[model samples]
Structures are given as C-alpha cells and as structure tokens.
Target: MRRLLRLTFRYLFLALLAWVLLSLLLVVPLKWINPPITMVMIDRWINNSSEDFKLRQTWLSWDEIPTHATLAVVASEDQLFPFHRGFDMNAIQQALRERERRGQLRGASTISQQVARNLYLWTSRSWIRKAIEAWFTLLIELTWSKQRILEVYLNIAEWGPGVFGIEEASLHHFGRPAAQLTPMQAALLASTLPSPLRYDPANPANHLRNRANWNLEQQRRLGGAQWLAPLNER
Candidate 1:
C-alpha cells in the first residue's frame, strides 16, 4: 500500500508538471513555432483515431472568410468577444440561474473558452474538465492576439458533421468560397453552431431560420463587422 501511494504521488506530480509546461507552451513563444492547425486537420485526426467520431468537413483562413461571417458568429454566439478577458462572468451567472430554473444543465462558454476547449481538451463535461478549460482559456488570451484567437475559432469551430471551418462550410453549403458567403449564408452557418447535427443549413428549420435572422439583425445593428473587418485584414 505504501509503494502504491508513492507511485500515485509520483504520477500526480508528473501530470501536474506536464500540465504546467503545456500551459506555458500554449501561452508563450512556443505558439509562434506551432503555427495554426485548422479544424479540418483536427477532425481528420480524430476520425482516423476513432470510428465513433466524424466531422462533416471544412477549413478556412481568416482572410478567406467574409467579414460578415465572423460578425454573424460573434453576434449569435458571443457578442462581447472583444471585451471579455477570457470568460464572460455575466453569461456564466445567467446560465447558472437559467439552469436552476429549468432543473437542467446548460452552459455559457464564450467563443474564447470554446476555442481553448476545442483545440486542447477532450469532449467531456465535468467540473475538472471545466477547470482545465478555464486555465487554457486564460493562457490563450494572454498569449494569443484577439485576431489570432478569432482566427483559430473560425477554423476550428464545428459547423456540421465532417464540416469544420468557414471555408469548407461555405463550399459545401453554398458552393462558394467563404469570403464570398452572403449575409444570409453566414447567418445560417452561425445558427448551426448550437447544434450543427440538428440544424441543416441547406434547409433550415423554422427555429434555425428565426435564430439566423436574429443573428443577422444583430450583425446589422453592430455596424456590419466594422470591429472585425480590421482583424480579417490582418
């Protein structure tokens, strides 16, 4: 029992050390060397490793995607991406209150947090996982520029089964490049993020259409991507 305890302690120490090193790598100069890996690559790797997981298929660069595409996503998913440090405390509080009212579990992870989770963490829901997610999110925000964060988010966010980034999503859905996706197409894509499997962009359900329309209105109200236009150019 004593030997087992020692071994457990040793492993725990190693795990903690590795986690710290990884956090540093993600947040520091190491990221400069890693370049950016797209969602398409990640999805392909996941699919190759396991028969259970499969993505629709898509990949896009920051410039390849239209300004409205980013705006639509931000308006629909996270309106305060430019201001948030990493987590949106207000949204978290609201989500918790709503969950209590509904007697169900819900989430309010912002785009930055979601990017951290999707890029580094596994698809598991637990307090421990969430804590790790928060840590990585902090690191990402500290180390990466806002433009880099959004670029990563756009490339990695799952649009549909096998469809990964805006580029692939635009080509698959509208037979156009992501840079050319219209406001309606961008809004439709943004609407699918909540539940891509359930919401078909080609034939949006009533609820999805309403949600997309709402996002479009929000984008228009926010000055049509003026905030993110500069980022897209970078």
Candidate 2:
C-alpha cells in the first residue's frame, strides 16, 4: 500500500510538471505577440450564453497607447511598478497592515501581477490561484521586458464587461481613440479599472471622480510619462 501511494504521488507530480511545461511553451510567445483571447474573455462568453454577445478588444502596440494611460495606471494601481520585479513587498506589507486595521482587504496588485492574471489566470481570489499567479508573474518578469508586460497588461485588462484594451475602451467611453485622450480622460479610465462595471468612466460617480483626481495628482507627482523611460527596451 505504501508503494502504491508513492506511485500515485509520482504520477501526480509528473502530471503537474507536464502542465507547467506546456503552459510555458504556450505563454512565452506572448512576449512578442498579442494573445488572440484570454481566459476571462472565454469565461464571460460562457456565462452570457448568447449569440449576440461579443467581446470588444483592439490590439495596439506599446507606442500606440498614449503616455497618459500608462502614467494613470501606474499612479493609481502600482506606484512602484518601475522599481519592483514582479511583486512589491512594501505594498504587500502595507496592504496587510491596512487590512488588519480596517478589517477589509484592499488591492495591492502590481501591474506585473495583473498582467500575469490577465494573461494566464482567472479573476477569483484564492490562495491556490495566488500561488499560480506568482509563478506566472515570475516567469513573465524573467521572459518579458517591463514594457512588454505593461503593454500586455494594458491591452488585456478588462475595461468593462465585454470591453478589453484602451483602444476599445476609449472609443466605447469617450468617443475618441486612445491616442487623443487628455490627462483627465485617461485618469478617469484608469480610475474605473478597479471595478469597471461598477464605475462608468463616461459618467463618473463622486467616488470615481475623486479617484480620478487622485490619479491625476499622482501622475503629476510621479513625473508623468517621463518615468516610463526606464521601461523602454534598449
């Protein structure tokens, strides 16, 4: 019986190894190439179960997306993105402290972490899911440049229920292309990213408006798009 149990464990380990290797093969190419679809898109489609339901996403290269959008997200979601590898230890500690004090968990996910989730994982919050996300985050940080990670994150992040990417989001919300978004317009979009369905960028609630203002201030404080200089591939 001990031998039988050992054999079962061996096969299970092999199966897990094979799964990770297969995923690496599939996911590594996305460093240079845009993914045709993400798991979230598929999940949303399945839940809707309607033929008329369409997922909106437009792939734009890193340069095509305006600097305002990048700065806004960095300021709003991950202020230490440029300095951190995949995880921000300081932010995590702060978030933990805040959770203890407030009795509510607030977001501390970095852009790299978000890219890992948006690219390779699902939305649910679980310890198992977080472990997988950390593995993929490490893989991505090693395999892809910071700019590539941000580009993929920007493009794959869900702007609304069916809407994905800034290009689609800009057109859907502001009636303009992403290239033309002003600082305020871009900040508003970034502010909605936390809960896109709950907060509409076109018609921002008071909370969202306040957050947008905060993002704009943070963007200015962080030296705006100039900080993105480090992200550019040499």
Candidate 3:
C-alpha cells in the first residue's frame, strides 16, 4: 500500500510538471510565432457538416490588417482589450449578476481570455475547461504583450462557419483583402463575431445590420484607430 501511494504521488507530480512546461512551450513562442492551427478550427473542421463548411485562413501581420478591422473587434467584443490584464472583472461581475437575475448565461470573455480558449482549448463550457482556459489565459498574458494577444486573436478567431482570421473573413464577406476593408465592412465583420455560426455578414439580416451599424458608432466613440495606440506600448 505504501509503495502504491508513493508511485501515485510521483506520477501526479510528473504530470503536473509536464503540464506546466507544456503550457510555457505553447504560449511563450507564440509571442513571435503565428500558430498554424488552433483547437477551435480543428473542432469546427471535425463537427461541421453543412455544405457551406470550408476551412480557410490567411495570416496578415498587424500592419497588414487595417486599423479599421482591428478597432471594430475591440469595440464590439471587448472595449477594454488594451486595459485589461487577462480578464475583465467588471464584465465578469455583470455577467454573474445577469445570470442570477435572468437565469441565463451570458459571455463576458475578454479578448485575452477568448484567445486562450480558442487557441488552446476545446469548445466545452465545463468547469474543468474553464479552469484550463484560465490557466492558459494567465500564461498568455504573462508571456505575450497586449498587441501580440490581439494579433493572435484576429488571426485565429473564427469569422464564419469555417472561415478564420481577418484576411479570410474580409475576402469571404466583402471580396476584399483585410487592408482594404472599409470601416463599415469592418463593422459588419465584427458584428458576426459573437455568433459567427449564426450570423452571416455577407447577407446580414435586420438585427445584424443594426449591430454592425452600432459597432460603427462605437468605433467612433472609442476614438477610432487612435484608441489602439496604447497597445503599441504594452
């Protein structure tokens, strides 16, 4: 019994050590290296069976993706992207309160948290998955700058059923490259991000149109592309 217990503990220690080291290896280099594929893309490729399902992604460097495209996502998804460390406590608190009052879950994930989960995790809402996501989120924030985080998020984020990244999304939606995306076109893309599978940016319905317009308004409110200047510093 003593030998069995000792071996169990030793194995557990090794497992924990391996997990930590693996996470560092996964995150640290990503500060400079773009990921070839993300877990989210793999999940979509495996599960999606619709006729429209087509896997596509094109990496555009930060400078290649226009500020309009970048700012639209920041305005629509997480306006606090440049300021938050890894999580947005205020949004989390608000989501908690909303769940308690409405008995429905709402997402309050920051851009950093979304990057961690989309890049490294499976699409499950289990507590275990959340815990792992939090671990990766911490590692990402610690190892990479805010700009790098957003760059990865834009590159890896699923824009539609199988379309990924700003470049592919721009082409898929508007028949233009990311750099040529107009402010309205960028806003339209941003509006689909919350429910990319459900909302079609190419032929937006009434709600999507309203949301895109709202995103455009918010972008102006956020002081346009200049709002992202802080990301350069951190």
How well is each residue in 76-135 modelled by candidate 1, as lDDT tens digits? Answer: 888888888889999889978997899765778999898877877767577787898899
lDDT of each: 0.77, 0.86, 0.89
Model 2 lDDT, full chain set: 0.86
Candidate 1 off by > 4 Å: 1-17, 26-59, 229-234
lDDT of 3 at 8: 100
Q: Mind sharing the TM-score for model 2?
A: 0.90
What lDDT tens digits, residue by residue, belong to model 2 across residues 1-234? Answer: 999999999999999999889878866998878899988888788888678879999999998989889889888888888888899998888988998999776667889888877777777777788788888888888888989988988898888879999899999999999999988999999998767878789998899999999998888888878978888952
lDDT of 3 by residue, 64-157 (tens): 8788888999999999888778899998899889989998767789899999999999887766887898899999999899889988889988
Q: TM-score of every model?
A: 0.81, 0.90, 0.92
* Pairs of residues clashing in candidate 2: none
Better of 1 and 3 by lDDT: 3
**Model 1 compared with the native: what TM-score?**
0.81
Q: Sum up the clashes in candidate 1.
A: 8
Poorly placed runs, candidate 3 (over 4 Å): 1-10, 50-53, 102-104
